[model samples]
Target chain A: MNERSLSTTTRATVPIHRRATLWDRLLEPVLGVNACFIYVFLYMPIVVLIAFSFSASPFSAVWGGFSIDWYIQLFQDSEIARALRNTLIVASFSMLFATIIGTMTALALSKFQFRGRNAFETTLNLPIVIPDIVQGISLLMFLVLVVHLALGLPTIIIAHTVFNISYVAVIVRARLHGFDRRLEEAAMDLGATEWQTFWKITFPLIWPGILSGALLAFTLSLDEFVVTFFVTGPGATTLPIQVYSMVKRGVTPEINALATLMLVASILLVTLSILLQRRRSS
Target chain B: MEKQRERGQLALLLLPSTLWLGLFFLAPLGIILVISLVQRGGPVAWQLDGSAYVRLLDPLHLKIFLRSLTLAVLTTFVCLLVGYPLAYYIAQRPPRLRHLLHFFVLLPLWANSLVLTYAWMVLLRPEGFFDSLLHALGFAEPISLLYTPTAVVIGLVYWYLPFMVYPLYGSIEKFDFTLIEAAHDLGATRFQAFRKVLLPLTMPGVMAGSLLVFISALGTFVVPALLGGDKTLMWGNLIQQRFLSTPQDWPLGAALSLAMMLFMSVGIWFYFRVNRESA
Candidate 1:
């Protein structure tokens, strides 16, 4: 009787174990499907954009046939070229200015302790949280009324630098957070002047952060729209503004081509930065 | 002598950025605040009138503010739902594979948001690729995905998911697996282990990510403008229209901008407070 009861209990528990295994089996594939679906959802639009960039249809919806005509036209269009050039000029200037200012601020904040430090840090990051539209309009109004700065490349550069500096400061600050101060002290003890020590020791140590921050700032300046939209005068139309106007008019095949190029360039830059960051961390 | 020189060097290093912020950011924002206090029309037009604050209290503007808040809240909730699982899965992966997964997470962020909006516009259009694909898959009707609030949500969620994911990933990666094992070993079920152990540990990351996504989504203009179409109206578009379009009401625009800034400042203040307490 006892053996019979034991067998019955084993039979009951074996099915429960089997059911648990089955549950695991079921969930594993479900999880895989979920991941795949999310990734596809994220990437499918980009894939379609690239695919239709080559489509012969003037409109994106009807894929008449495959052709690179839009791309060829993009090259031939002087306006697009001019916008691209202006964007590069603006981004380059913004990147340069933001990098220098950002690095300097990061160095100061990391090395020094003073009253109002928290307030300063928060204030620097304030631009990040402010809506771009508000920043743009306010800056536009201010440029027109208060500062009387020309609403052209200079204004755009200044506005870009304002936002870009925060990004640079944040990234460089992250790198600076765990930096070994002893190295700087060692250099100083070895009789290096502050400027020479910074150039030889601190600058080189923080070079990657500066580079990454500069790259990030460059990318931001390249892609910045709303602020540029408000600040840009008639003579200075960047690629994003051009794209916005194009989008407003209607979707066109040429825009798909231009967008694909922009997407590719940005991806390359970001990938390079990520790779560099990983290398440094490793 | 060296200490003085170091202080001088630090001052020199700090001067440029400080000046940039003082001139561009702080000064302009101050100007906006001053303008927000002024009347719409008068002989001394720019003089402080306090009427713009009253204008800000108008129901239409209030409605727009509420709509922005609703959208941002919804976006943050959805991002959390979607991002948490993916972050967990990535965190569970081996270190080598984790980096690859993170690269994909970062990929969307690298692409220009405008281009992403355009991509969605293409896919979500009436006869767009997505509609065609759905029809080919045996659906009788093409879904009306474009120019809807749903599209706005999708764009917002898509744009901000990375912001949510990265922070969660940061936290999850640092989570103590041993605690989970201990919970399980104490006869707790798998779900119980996750709830009692893992969730609490990752809460900080969740909070940070959600706040970042919420603040950004609240202010987003391009996504809504491009994807929301005629049906959906958010404050960003409203503010843009007032400033740039036919109305050209600088006072109203300035008032709206000030109100938005005030809202953001309050939100950020709360966010920092919570973060500080948690830390």
Candidate 2:
């Protein structure tokens, strides 16, 4: 073990010696420039959008003086408000439904050893790999024809639930995979009922995963467009669909402000969830 | 008695998700498959026919299919090329810096894709930010970057890079760096050590990342619609227009969607087969 450690330590030091080679010096500037270019490529557009959100120009490209009029106008637009309301409603229900179903699926799959279990697991993940458009169109056709369901919030919720289920299931399943099943067995041996064991033991242990999954589902539903676009009826337009239409017509400052706000909110929520997950794991 | 109840409870737990997916996902996909085979304009309008399949064989439809396939393949290739190095660099970093690097990578994913596309449009349009920057730099004419195939490819690459990076990062993080050191100690050069030890070890992550990006890019609608504009006609946009618009050509739309589904299913089937065999 000493010899192995010595040899490995010496070998690792080789890269340090080679770092000052001629080729390394030549490539150092090139690498720096490349990194700069990639950074600019990634961020310039976002900066532009944020900057132009305050532009007084109705058109995005032409920059007139800055004003918050579009932001004010956005507030007064009833359609936008209605769309926002619809989106929140759909997202809330979808997130709630997906979290419950996904948590159940995760618990069942992780705890059980039934035949065709792999097939079930694969099927659960299939919707995520399938193209959203295909899934959306297919769901639209099914609801209209086979199920005879109306095209509105219910349809959007169901469609969103399809994607959200897989996401939540995967995350919660991952958490369960690392879980100590012995804890549940111990709780049961201690005379706790199954419900009591789950609520007091399992649920508390996996609550972070459940919360993260819910947040993910919520974010996905909030930003969902293609599926929502297909299934939504006239008055069921969500924020993303509304933003898409506004862009297709032409770019405007209001969209930038809307997008920026969404960006901040999503980032904050996801960050919080990730931190919660880390804390739980640690 | 306790074990039996536990089994029963487990079954009950699975019932809800299974029933929901059976009713929603599996059933809907089945409906799409059936719809794909049917022809429009019959007395029983939505009745089964082979005309949709026939329409799928048309040159235009075939072209769209090929275009989508090519775009997906190219996007996967670019993402792998770009993401691998970044993942490697992040993996090589000190543990303290690794989390920060990963945060930067994941930042884009947290933001909405549609919003990202719009940001790209604002930056890349002829008279937009890029043009203004270039003109200020003394370029006479504005560069026409928007509504082009290149822009579409850029958008695809940008949006999907993090997806590729994370999986690769996961694999790289798990890799035993001592293997590379062992190779080096055995008189291998730096390049040889990396080529033989590091490369082969990270192959699974590379494959997973590439497969995920390629499959997702194949069906991408938002990027092409927003960035490529009307000039480029990806299958996603085509399917949407056909089904959702006034023409309401359900048969053609279903055919197109089914074709995309079939194409991706084959790709995924092949990917899993290869991955399983390799594993």
Candidate 3:
């Protein structure tokens, strides 16, 4: 009877064990392979470009030998230097405007109950959902018609700020969501004026949020292409526009070097932002 | 008195952003809508007409829209298939390593898109890296991969895959593995367990990622312009050529832009509806 029960129990569990093992054997390798293949696919082209940037030859596709001549050449290119200056100007000014406006918006949304709050929220999020092309076209048309704003640095900065404000607001508002309000209340209760309390208590706490938001806005505006493409006038070409034009005329080794440097800069900024955010949260 | 002061304070805080958005974003969109109904005379002139809207119903524009839609849908599908597994693997990683993996996934976005596309050009051009590798592997001939629809799709997927992966990772990171264990305990097979439990649980990520990828893919002009040679002009290129190229058909471009916006709203509505039901 014991033997019979053991055999029945074995029969009951055997198929399930077989199925589980079979599924794992089939799927585990497939999943691993898929994951590895995707990683390679994602990084290979980038790696190829970075490696070829140092080639002694002018042709990017064919590597000759190791040399930094392209890097030196990139520094001497007057047009690229001008684009870089334009890019920095737009990114910094736009970042400043976006941060101030966005922080205030975030503060208002978080601290108060108001009429049309939902409408305001939706308006802020609209740019995120709307296609970039639509945004670019509409903004271009508006600048050209209603404002008669000349396509130049100012227009580009304004366009960048328009979308970037929402990004900044969202990030700061996320910080405000978990904020401790009692400290501000305590400062108010202890005879601190509203403005003074804000300067002393609240601002210091959300300072990280504002800084990170500024960084994000800077990064976005620096690399913004589509809208800038629409609004940019002669002598106002940003790095991306310059890069686009260069790519159109067949990439030179100088561009490859420039691209590699830009990639490294972007990675460094993003990593710094991540570290700042992590430090704040921790 | 306190409430009044609070209201004033809030208004003071909100005014600048509101004014900026109103003057720039909302007003521009309104102007575009009006421009769509007007006839283009030249770069700076317009006549009140609706020829652009009428032209959209023509077979040619409709075909372009359908083609863009098809490409977007395909790109989204491929991204989902590739991104879901990658995100799942990343989410399964130890917590300390997950952040690094996520950063790696997003590294491409930090790099300029034009440069990224140029990299692909280097890899896929005639006698390029991909061709050379294949040739070295005993392949007799190089593949004509550049300036093709397949090349365009590959570039789009590479450009936007991180957007998909990030959202999926967000949703999947919060996934409850206990339910899978429960299914296993209930004698369901692994396939049945995943289909019944894991898939349903991660549907939100799938929808979110798909929506993000689809809209962006549909609106992209650069990928197609760079990778999709002259023959494979999508809707975005059509809109671009209208405004920037010969003829400068601003009205038609506005109409096309509005159509895309309308389509996006519909997609977003459907997404929210699905999201609410799932919630």
Top candidate on TM-score is 3
Residue A202 error for model 2, in Å?
A: 1.7
Error of 1 at A266 (Å): 0.5
lDDT of 3 by residue, B1-279 (tens): 999999899999999999999999999999989988887777535678988899777898888898889889999999999899888777766565677888888888877787788888878887777777777688888797999888989999999999899889988877766566667778877779879988999999999999989988998988888888787788888888888898888888889999988888888899999999989
lDDT, each prediction: 0.83, 0.82, 0.85
Candidate 2 lDDT over B1-279, as tens digits, reads 978887888889989889888988899888877877776753116566888778777898788778878888899998887777777666655666677877888788878889989888878887677777777678888798799888989999999988898899999877777776567557777678778988888888988898889888889999999888777778898899878766667788877888777877787788789888878
Residue-wise C-alpha lDDT for candidate 1, range A1-282, written one tens digit per residue: 243343333223223332355644565576566667778878988988998998876444546798999999999999999999999999999999999999889989999986788998888998887889988988887898887777888889999999999999988888888788998899989999778888998778778888989998999899999899899998899999999999999988899999999999988887777665545632
Ranking by DockQ: 2, 3, 1
Candidate 2 accuracy as TM-score? 0.91
lDDT of 2 by residue, A1-282 (tens): 243443344335345434444643544365445445555666766777777878876344556788888789889989899989999999999999999999999988888888899899889998888888888888888898887988889899999998899999998987887889899999989999989999999998888899999999999999888888889887788999999999988877788888877777787888887876676554
Please identify which of the two predictions, 2 or 3, would achieve the higher DockQ against the true structure.
2
DockQ of candidate 3 against the true complex: 0.49
Sliding window of 10 residues with minimal summed lDDT for model 3 chain A: A5-14
Candidate 1 has an lDDT of 0.83
TM-score, chain B only, every model?
Answer: 0.92, 0.91, 0.93
In model 3, the clashing pairs are none
* Candidate 3 lDDT score relative to the true structure: 0.85
